[model samples]
Target chain A: MPVTSSRPVCILGLGLIGGSLLRRLAGERPAFGYNRSTATVNAAVADGYDASSDLPQTLTRAAETDAVIVLATPVTVLGPIVDAVVEHAPDCLLTDVVSVKEQVARIVAHHHPDARYVGGHPMAGTAHSGWAATDPSLFENAMWMVTTHDDTEADDWLAVADIARAAGSYVVPAAEDAHDRAAAAISHNPHVTAAVTAAVGAGESRLPLRLAAGSFRDGTRVAGTAPELQRAMLEANSVALLNTLSETIDRLVAARDRLRDHGDVAALIEAGHRARTAYEEVAAGEVEPIVGVTIGDDGWAQELRRQAHLARVWVG
Target chain B: MPVTSSRPVCILGLGLIGGSLLRRLAGERPAFGYNRSTATVNAAVADGYDASSDLPQTLTRAAETDAVIVLATPVTVLGPIVDAVVEHAPDCLLTDVVSVKEQVARIVAHHHPDARYVGGHPMAGTAHSGWAATDPSLFENAMWMVTTHDDTEADDWLAVADIARAAGSYVVPAAEDAHDRAAAAISHNPHVTAAVTAAVGAGESRLPLRLAAGSFRDGTRVAGTAPELQRAMLEANSVALLNTLSETIDRLVAARDRLRDHGDVAALIEAGHRARTAYEEVAAGEVEPIVGVTIGDDGWAQELRRQAHLARVWVG
Candidate 1:
């Protein structure tokens, strides 16, 4: 059975993720959203979405119904939203669509200690952002990380996982810090790497730029992401990002030295090919599934995390 | 006017590039190709194109007609092929589709110094290789590097440039050394970086593997290229590859250090975003074209190289 509650979902900040979620879940549940921009709110309302520019009023409505609240704002502007949540909807089950988990979890724990919170990050996005780019099917088949904390409640975890499923994603349960580290490896560090590659390709001459083809274009694609938005997530996960970035630099530098000294890049290219093959196998769904763990058993969070570490998902 | 050469083109090694070129240029100008594999030759001949496995006979035929001999084999195999060209077609205007121009230029200079030669590198490929993977339109609108050495003949250069245009590409006039350096900056170094990124993403745990998305996917797409082919090109351009790799490493290390020391990746991210914007503008064809230069004048090669340095194309 799907672990779900009938409580309404209140989405804070109707940007891409929030607006999409509201669109997907609006008719199914008593879902509503808040955006700071009146123009966006009016547009959403005109499109028959229950959206408003009033933050406190939206939070109060969510609190009155004991709703599940999703924070879909950028990490930079999250503090004030959390503050508003604390003042008006302290009893709500909290979750987020933030890129980094530990920072948001820390903020929740610091600002509203008694709030029932489970951090979430749906691994989906396009190069575009804002409400205009929002799509209802943004999270289809995407991995939504529902994080586990020492103080995480079973019911709260189930609530957020239900939201993730409703948004059309598989749930990958992880601890807050582990989520950040894995994200650094997969997302944050890749951003920095892409940025560096793009900057280097755009060097002192136009020749490299003219000669660049598929590899350069694809490798440096994410470097086109908004600088401030990238900085926010990258800086928020600095510790893990720093470690991952250093590891990447080490690998690149070693490859360089090998090429300089031995005139061969076979080892690095071979290893990378093997890794890419591994990814292809998983992506093709050729790998057998790991055994599943029940939600809310003794040591269930740890067991779920272990299974997730093994690349298993709980599509609850 | 389109530079036209009625000379037949003989391609040695019917791999992806050669096979595609043969398919494209077969009827336009008398074109035939030779592959070591009998199956590939049979397949091409069955498709109603002139292809053969007999290298000596092919070169001898080309010798009688004074055809342009395009050395389309890998760099490692070029020495013997150049020797064959010297033996059978010493007076033929020679060229190659090699990835690195300087190495092929050096080989031609050593083996057939009196042979009129220009090196060409077409910036096009799929991950797949071999005759089956060949597509007739691979070079459509692609940039094809036509290299100039101190002894490069105007008519010889025009012959290769004509072939590139006939195969549907924009001609980029560059000196052999400059082509290798530009290629290292755009292609070879990007391959190494992708390999490192893929290897790093596939660390000890499967979490990163499962979490890999579009950025990681595109960033490491070239890591999936056949290892031997990548090694051939990367190793051949070791000097330029080493320099570009070191520059990338330095930039990544600085980004890492900044993230560690001051919690700021703004400079790097900002610079990268600006560079990506520049690429976008150029890719969108918003950049103005440089003034065209005449093909055979005093310092014409130097003038064409200068225009190419400003991201101009000769499309002749």
Candidate 2:
């Protein structure tokens, strides 16, 4: 069953993530927002979001009434935010929208013994940030990855899911450590690699960069990702990031070595082609109604009849 | 002045590049195509491109009449083809459309004293290859990098430019070594890095790949590069590739270290953000109509009048 509560969700920090959530769920579900910057809070209020800059007042109101409160601040500020929430809003189910999970989970666990906490990360963002860039449909078709600490009750899980679902996101279950490792492989290392590639083009002449239109531009596009947010992710998941980058460097070295020795790079390219093809196949399969079949007027008809016994078949 | 030769060109190997060129130029410029496989040659003929399987006969026709001959084959087969062309079509202005420059230039130089050779590479291709996938507008707005060896007459330069122009490509002047180095840094290394990144994702489960839709997908999209062509490029420029790859590893290591030791990744990310912004700005500038200026009522108009004095200015 879905979490049903009359209490509004209290969103801390009205940046991109928080503002997007507020925009997505303001009318359907009541949301109160708090941000460190008073200007941003005022802007959010002006834009029709219920917002306040006073932390204690907001936390007091949330603790007294809200079903869940979302902390959408950077990782560095999370410890103090969690502590403050624990002291002031101990009754509400607390969750966070940080990129790194294990450290965030540890923070919640350390500030535990009162209110429960669930890890919630909606995997949707752009290179642009701030409240003005917020879109109500930002989370549509996005994966809202979640992890649960010991104190996370079933009701608490449902409450987080309700928030994500209200924003049109599908909740994906994840173990904290596994999530970090996967994210390092998929996100952090790719960002660093893209940055390195982009830096190669950032030289004296603008000709190469000008000529870098198609594959090079698309391939290294993520090098423009928001600096602070990326910094938070990479530093927070340092161990995993290091491991992923190391493995990738090793793979690149091997390809380079093979090219050096045999004067052949087909093996590496072929391997890449296989992986890319698999991803394409899977993505294509998601859209296809049916793949690879032959229908005849024989035993296949009997099998079809058996499968479709509940419905009448019409001859076309 | 443009090379105004009316000589019909010979295109060896009716694959992706050759077929695309033929399709683009056949209506205006005459082209005679040759391929090793009879099926491909027949397919080319069926598609309205003049082609045949007999190498000597086609080469003889091109040598007797045409001003330019384009060897559109794989790198491994380039050596024998150039040798054959030297023995058979010695007077024609020889050229080949290959990804690698230095090695192909070396091959042309070694088979010398007979036919002139100009290195031509139109940086336009897809993962798909062969005659069926050929598009007439394949090289439109693409950079056709070229290098000329000895015996490259005024007629030879224009002949090559004629073919490139016919395919709607602009000729980019490049020295063989500089071209190789720049291509290694921009094209070859990026391909290998993307391949490695894509391979990192090709594991047991499809979950990570499923979640890899945004930056991960965009960053590694070039992993689908044609295996043989990309392999030719990476292997041919292995020395440059290795140097580029090593430097990238160093940058990535530094980023990883920053994240690990100081818990700071902002510097690296900020550098990346700056580079990305510059590229975006340059790309945006390509389309914009003279940005960043203020036209004051009095002094600015007088300054503009003064600047426009060297040339005639039409009033809007």
Candidate 3:
């Protein structure tokens, strides 16, 4: 059954992700958004989004509606945002889109136990930020990873998946620690590597770097990401991130040692070749597709045919 | 004085670089391009270039012309190609467009002591290969790093620079060692890193990768590079490349350690910020442009004045 409601959906924190969600939801539902900055709220309003800078008014409005409140703030701000949402929207289904999950899970467990809350981290973003940089397609084809703790309700987890599906993201279920470790390996560590490479090259000849064309520019592009947020993510998921970093360092060291001792350049090149081949295999779909796949089996096909035949007989 | 030339230019190995050079030179001077493949020679001829599959005819024609012979083969093939070019174009100034300088320099010294061979590596390439990928603008805005050994004549070195400039590359002078190190740091090692990152990610899950939107795809896109050439480069510059890779890994490890120890994620992020800031500073011409800067200070000021004058000139 469709849980149809005319009440507005309230989004807390009108940053890039929040703004984007509001922009998409406004087409279907009565959407309202609140940000700390009045200027940002005014800009959003001017851009045809129903938004306000008044947090109290926003929370009050959220409490009255059968709306789901989404906290789209940084890891540090998540706890406080959840507290505020709990005080205001006592009956609302609370959710957060913070990258780190353990801390958020703990916070919800301690404070907002009465309110249903699900922790989500959508694996998507650009190097840019703010409401101006928000795009509706940002979440499209993205993995919305949800982490469930012992305190998380089954109903709330399902609701979180529904929200992710509605936002055009494939729901990926993972434990808090597992998600953090995986994220560190792929995303967090890579960002740090890019930054360090840029730093080392920058220390060398600044002149040659300026002349750096496509490859260098693209490689270090993510180094331009927001400092404070990156720091928070690193701090929040420190242990896992450090482990991945160590592994990466060891790989490089091994390559270096082989070059110094063996003089076998071919072996070094083969490593790179193997890596590239593996990556291509994944990208080309020679391996399993990451997103969900719907397969209609022989039994399903037979059932469909039988149903079609029955329908045809009834029509005749 | 322009060396009065009755002799045609001989281009050995008519691949993309060689074929492009042949096509360009055919329009301006009498040129002969030799390819091992009869089909390649026929195709070049059909494309209106003066090319031959017959080695003796090509060598005899090369000997007859006061031609400069250019070797445009891979590093492994450079040794034999140099021997052939030395045997044929003894009096002609010889050059090459090989990526590595040290190996080519060593080969030229050992086999072609009598030939005027200046080592050149054009920092320009497309992902594609073959004669069909040849473009006139291939060398445009490219840095043509030239290396001269002790035996190289000043006039021969000057001739190579003149060719590079005419082909639209700004020639930069460097030692073979320096060029190799720089190429390893910027080009070779980075390719390996991209390849490894891609491979690791691919090994984990192809589905998540396919669902990988912009940033992940863009970051690892270079991993799709030709495995054979990528490996060859790694092998050739293994020592220098390993050093670069080690340095990069150390920085990444340090950043990760700081995060792990809960030392200060903010500081690490700040380091990243500083690194990116430096990169931008270098990129924006606050530092010297990598491809040798064309405009002098006086010329730049005059150009600015000229642009202002043009605005006034047009208005008036």
User: Which pairs clash (backbone N, Cα, C closer than 3 Å) in model 2?
Assistant: none
In candidate 3, what are the lDDT values of residues B1-316, reduced to their tens digit?
A: 2543333578888877787777666666677788888888888889888888876677767777666777886677777776776666667777888777887778887887776677887777655667888887887766676664444455666667666766676665555776677677666666656655544443243333433434445555555556666666567776677677777767666666666665565655676678677657644532222331232332432332233211110000
Distance from true location, Cα of A107 in model 2, Å: 2.0
Q: At residue B140, what lDDT does model 1 achieve?
A: 89
Give Cα distance to truth, residue A132, candidate 1, Å.
2.3
| True-structure lDDT of candidate 1 | 0.85
Give the lDDT of residue A267 in candidate 3: 47
Expressed as tens digits, the lDDT of each residue in B1-316 for candidate 1 is 2346567999998889999999999989889888889999998998888999999999999999778899999989888898998899888888899898878888888888787888899999877888889899999888899986545678778889899989988888888878888888778888888888888788757877877777788888888899988898899999888888888988888888888889999989998898888877767674334465666777788888888888888855
TM-score of chain B of 1: 0.95
Please state the CAPRI-style docking class of candidate 2.
acceptable
lDDT of 3 by residue, A87-168 (tens): 7887887777777777777777777877677778778888878899888777875667765444446555566656666677
| Candidate 2: regions farther than 4 A off | A1-7, A42-52, A148-152, A287-316, B1-9, B42-48, B64-67, B148-152, B202-204, B266-271, B287-316
Worst 10 residues of 2 chain B by lDDT: B307-316
lDDT of each: 0.85, 0.71, 0.64
Candidate 3 lDDT (Cα, whole model)? 0.64
lDDT of 2 by residue, A247-283 (tens): 7777767766776678777777888788787767754
Clashing pairs in 1: none
After aligning candidate 2 to the native by TM-score, how far in Å is the CA of B192 from where it should be? 1.3
lDDT of 2 by residue, B1-316 (tens): 2455355778988788888988887867677888999999888888777889998888888878854888899888887888788777887888888878888877877775555777788877766788888888888867676563333454565567567767787555455665676677667777877777777765435545544556777777888767777776677777877788777777767776776678677766787788788778765653222122233223433332232222111111
Cα distance off (Å), candidate 2, residue B189 = 0.4
Interface RMSD of structure candidate 1 (Å): 1.2
